[model samples]
Target chain A: MKKILRTHILLFLLFALLLPSCMNEPVMPPNTNEGNFEALWKIIDTRYCYLDYKNINWDSIHDVYKTRLATDTTEFEFFDLLGDMLAELKDGHVNLSSNFDRSRYWNWYTDYPSNFSGSLISSSRYLGKDYRVAGGFMYQKIANDSIGYIYYGSFSDGFSDTNMWYIMNYFIDCKGLIIDVRDNGGGSLESAEALASYFFKNDTVTGYIRHKIGDGHSDFSSPQEIVTKANKKIQWQRPLIVLSNRLSYSATNDFINRIKASPNALVIGDQTGGGGGLPFSSELPNGWSIRFSASPMFDRDMQHTEWGIQPDIIDSLKVADVERGYDTIIEKAIKIINQSN
Target chain B: MKKAGFLILIIFFNVSVYSQTRNADTYLLSNVANTFGFGAISVLDPYLSPLQYNGIGLKYDNDNLRFLDTEKLNLSRQSKFTITAAEALNPAFTSLMMLVGANYQYGMYYHFQPISDLKVLAGGSCDVDFAVKYLPRNTNNPVNMDMSTNLNISAMAFYKLKLLKRDVQLQLSLQSPLLGCMFVPQTGASYYELFLLGNLTDAFHFSSLHNKRGFQSRLLLHVPFKRSNWHVGFDFNMLKYSANGAVYKKDDFGLVVGTTFDMISFSGRKNLPPSNFKSITE
Candidate 1:
């Protein structure tokens, strides 16, 4: 009996010792200029959500960038090279971070018309000193107190349901409400969803989002439905006008995509600068952090929103009008609201 | 196929113990030990980040060992409980992963005195374990949870000797899981889908010796002083698993200190001891 136990125990130990040999782990490249370059390139090639969707020739870009890499390249020069490679994707949401600088691609907004004039919005003709601020929204009556205009510049700021209740009461008598999201470079998606909830009349299918499921470029999970439910107590049943420009991006783009479905909503002004992809963070072997788009979002029609979304009514701001103390886009929005009312 | 073969071998080794005679009616004493450990730990949770993190680990353990009610004192039962926590940072010093885990085990072991100073115990155990790894960096997937129940095999050795006219005891114990079921979500699955959208699909997985491997070994030295025994030991643990093309790992090596004591009680499951067995709690 004892011999049997001994033999079993010996055999068990032998099996336990052999189990580790089965471990299969990817071999991480050594930390060098070439190694960091490969790591950064692979992270984008495998995980970035918009590569195939945007029709980017990533392999060609990689070939062009590889020739610029030198063994003695300084860290700063290496960062610049990688930043240039990322720019080929033409995405504002992609960035590379180091102690010295953060690299970004601004052509999404920079190459377009600046349809918004900050100085004009703050003038007495519009949201002057009387404009009250609540929940990151700057509000006052415009068009001779006939219309309500609110300038919300960022989604990073948070507000509560109580704030929405009070804001609704303030706009109760206006002909319509204008939400100007120009020059807003996106912050939190939840904030965007919350603000959109007030405009939705009922539970609505706003859009869809897909997450990367594997390392392959086209590998993604089934599109999950993004539903925007109405805020029962603070519903905005009045005519809603959402303003956009070349700089309206990221979460702002998402908000525009959702609120556009409202029965009483009209999107006006320039096409929104689009950054519809949600970014996730990663790092290279050299310890520099890489932020890339890891999830893709779509509109109700399953249309890709990576490029700017078209306004139902297109309007552009001419510097000649700003100089003449007349905000033409606001004038057009007021004209439309008055006609609708 | 390879995993199924190893699982059958483990089950065969454990099932042979019940083939012995069913005449187990002898009352016996139980020894209980409580230990606390603290040491350095390293973690690599690829779902959280590509970088590895290093930090300190803390664990607490309670063990109860007692011979079963048998005619001969050759079979013993053991119950153990352990809890561990660790917080670590990525190599870039930009991210942090906080982890907490707990486990409980119960098993029966066979004792064999191969030599005058050497006693070896081998057995199989059934255990349940749960753990959570939290990384605040990810926007959509912030936390990953692990829950599993396992069948395990364990072995222990005890050597008693004299040095400098003093009697001392040395012990080595090892345990590993052979098969179980585990929760392994997709590599980058969104928590928003699982929690907010309430879509829970393809998260639970059947784990075997091939995909999941773990082992723990503890060595202790007991010193007799003032008619009581106090022990200091080192514990080493390693665990690695894969599912949905993602691999996760956790490793710990720590030092522990504890004391041993004997206990006896008149319970429904335990037989009443005769005059030969002493009960301190009686």
Candidate 2:
């Protein structure tokens, strides 16, 4: 009986000793205007990857934005103010979504010339109703039956294997394939990789991707290389011209970077809109949604492409050419194809 | 949290004197329970939202204990596994969050009997907990991952009595986490940064009373039948941890019903000790 009592006392004392060490301090700020402002500032300060690269003094930006936040500020006003603050990043992927409105920075494309004309492609360039639509691509023979023109408008769209195989077969007899990905704001990485795989004869290492492992700006994992091997079922061995414009972004930017590595591929048109970072979502205290780039992606040389990917041949649309119902970029691509052959 | 631990210890200490003896032939016992109840959840992730939600929870527990052969020094090894899922509602923004959690615990205890019908078990346990809470509507940050591994002190009391011409058993148990480590990203850190970039600073943190506190308690009742026992119970569990300026708290209480059975038992004169040789006629 004494032994049982002693054993019980010892166990009780063990837990009593542990009772003093368990209080934890709360980490989040209160849900007020000042608190929300600070939280937003901290979210970007810690999670946004481009602060150092973009050479923006985020501390000063916070100082400027905090002055705009008043106790009487309306929800829309606060939303606009936050949008203004994010605009400094000049990134298209950074967005603040609310029930009222969504904030976006579109200068990445709006400030540049619109090199693509949908009407011109439909009326004159796509062989005037002779083009066939297979999956997300509109393809036809151009340059008097010598060049294959394939216009892919968006990466958000998916295409089946059969669609791709048929498209490749249709272009099999052409001199070369002109792949136009203009105004494609990007979509699935799997789709992007699948499309890019066709240009390679062998396995290709196009770029690298790394995400945040900790809170520090410099805290990142070792870069994981992205490999896109050729799909032997319907590989494109002929000369390939990938046309891109300022609106080609995200996965489109990635496609351009990958295709640029292929020996038989050449990029033509304006520099692509850069959206190299993979975006993720979070929310503010006010229930407003926030989306920003979380992971950084790189090109084959491990260089950041968040700003934009430069084309091998820099060419802009000529107003006169548009008036004459011709695509300057497509014409240039056709010329290059003829010269290379 | 510490106050709660102290209260549990005091209650168990007072009940230790009435410990009852258990059948020497019993070796392995397995218990399983399924429960459902309502609880409250609070999350303070600056990237998500700062709101408290009330929701329903479903839980299940499986425990196994094997007693060692000893007279004065009675001992047992126990293993327990638990799964819980909860969905909460917040009227502030018409928002909701779903959390799914799983845990496993293993420990060894000293079993004691100070009276004819009461038994006390006390020991230390190590637990690993992993949970994920997801908000379907949050745009910027939609998910929070919760994970921790801790060493805890545990105590249990078992009481057996005859009621209505049938044998009944009642048991109460508590476990308090003492020390361990947890993973929590910084206030503004994203999983992309933590998982993809591999930035683990402040991610693996030491947990103690200052940064974490929680306890699990349960009261179970058993009614024996011909070959097995039908069990019914209530469980209350609370967990709270704060690190890198992010706070996570979960409180759950539910009614449980299950069954218990002995997996292996010693029988007859062959497995009995020589001291029981004359039990048939003496």
Per prediction, the TM-score for chain B is 0.84, 0.77
lDDT of 1 by residue, B1-282 (tens): 854454454443444343232234533557888898998888876666676778888999999998764465877878899998998877667667898999998876877688788898877788889988887765555677878888887889999988678898899898888788888777556666556655556677788787898887899988888978788999987788888887777788999999888876664433455556676876
lDDT per residue (tens digit) for residues A1-341 in model 2: 75767586567645543443354533545678787778778778877777777898999999998888889989888889999999999999999887889999999999999899888878755556879988888899888889888889888788977998998888888999999998888986768888998888898888887766556676666777778778878788899999999999998999999999988999999999999988776556666667788778899999999999999999989999999988898999999999988
**What overall lDDT goes with each candidate model?**
0.82, 0.77
Candidate 2, residue A224: the lDDT equals 72
**TM-scores of chain A across candidates:** 0.95, 0.92
Put down candidate 1 lDDT per residue, A1-341, tens digits, no spaces. 56775697678666665665467765555678888789889889988999898899889888999999998888899899999999888999889887788899999888888989999999998999889989889989998888999899999988889887888788889989999999998888888999999988798998898878888889988888889888888888888899999899999999999989888899999999998888877777666777788888899998888887899999998778899887778888899999997
User: Which 10 consecutive positions of candidate 1 chain B have the poorest summed lDDT?
Assistant: B14-23
- Model 1 misplacement above 4 A: A1-7, A124-126, A130-133, A141-146, A324-327, B1-33, B62-81, B89-97, B103-130, B134-143, B155-169, B224-229, B259-282
lDDT by residue for model 2 (B1-282), tens: 863464455333322322222345533343343333334444434335555566777777778876543332466657788887888865346577888989998776777677778888877777888988888875335787778988887888888998799989898888877788988766445564456435565677999867777767788888888876777778776667777655666666777777776654345655443454455543
TM-scores for all candidates: the values are 0.84, 0.76
Tell me the chain A TM-score of model 1: 0.95
Residue B224, model 1: Cα distance from true site in angstroms: 5.0
